[model samples]
Target: MTCTIFYSTEMPNEQAKVTGGIPTKPMRWAVDYVVKTPDGRTVVQGEKTIQRATFEELRAVMNHTIGEIGDEVGNEATFVSWRATAHGGKKKNRKGGKRK
Candidate 1:
């Protein structure tokens, strides 16, 4: 069996503006991932939030995730591809709306 892995980093976002709200810290970086079989069937997927947003943390999480995938798919499974990306950070304004 062959599989594909997709993962990415979740960027932090600033605190939102709200009335009578206590200021809270911005979100930390997180990793989101997905594993799929050759037939485009989703095997496993999840997101993990980490304290740090470094490459080392990302690598560690990825390795752990892959191991979990292996356990789920068995030893015959071969990774056919990998896709990674980064998401979040700044919120974009909606169309025809005022820019912050």
Candidate 2:
């Protein structure tokens, strides 16, 4: 089985760090990940706080999580088509209808 992981986050701004009044740090980023089928539809996803001190440990944790989900699903799910049409896009009428 294969999986892809994507990460995204917003860093705290200097202004907030200095001027904002908070009892603690503004934010912390845990490792957020998504698991998808072979053709790109999401199967399972989750986030876990950075607990391990090394890269290998973190990778092992993520792999184990994904493996558990895979085992439960029995690896029979098919990939879903992810194509989407544009919203409010213009299209010509084949019947020669009038345009507003």
Candidate 3:
């Protein structure tokens, strides 16, 4: 069935600037998604965690994912919402508290 998907991209750690030097590690991202119909029926949902060496590469990944989902679900499926947020340097525990 036709549906809309809401998704968000997140960087779990602080990003450093690309100064006049090369980095030794890549950046990671967590992309979470939820697909639901107009009447609130969930069709599909999942998260994809990926690492990239550059911002351009990250955009490429997101675009590819959106394109593939569109192709699979046909024109009726649309990504109506998208956001990019970052997490602080703290990991949460299962109880929703900050981990030490």
Candidate 4:
């Protein structure tokens, strides 16, 4: 159970203080990458913290990283809310559903 958390803030004033001194300003969303499967393809977790300026940028990074594993193995990718996982499961992926 390996999980990587990414935080981004869209506010011009608020910045993400991640590892090292490198700070990401204008943060908006955060992505929690859950790599539980050996085959990879974990998640594209996006939330309020992901900044508007960096949303697509972050998404692109996630897509390149683990998207292939899930797309190839499960043939499905989704945008899931961590808040909903506790109850049941509410996930919404891209329209095409898992890139071809």
**Total backbone collisions, model 2:** 0
Worst 10 residues of 2 by lDDT: 80-89
- Candidates 2 and 4 compared: the better one by lDDT is 2
Residue 84 lDDT, candidate 4, scale 0-100: 8
CA lDDT, every model vs. true structure:
0.46, 0.39, 0.46, 0.38
- Tell me each candidate's TM-score: 0.43, 0.39, 0.48, 0.25
Instruction: Name the TM-score of candidate 3.
Output: 0.48
Ranking by lDDT: 1, 3, 2, 4
Whole-model alpha-carbon lDDT for candidate 2: 0.39
**Stretches of candidate 2 exceeding 4 Å from the true structure:** 1-29, 38-41, 76-100
Residue pairs in clash, model 1: none
As for model 3, its CA RMSD to the true structure in angstroms is 12.4
TM-score (C-alpha, index-matched) for candidate 2: 0.39
Clash count of each predicted structure: 0, 0, 0, 15
Winner by TM-score between candidate 3 and candidate 2: 3
Per-residue lDDT for 39-100 in model 1, tens only?
66767666666553444444566677677777878733433223433334455576888865
State the displacement of the C-alpha of residue 66, model 1, in Å, after optimal TM-score superposition: 1.5
The RMSD (Cα, Å) of candidate 2 is 18.9
Q: What is the lDDT of residue 71 in candidate 2?
A: 75
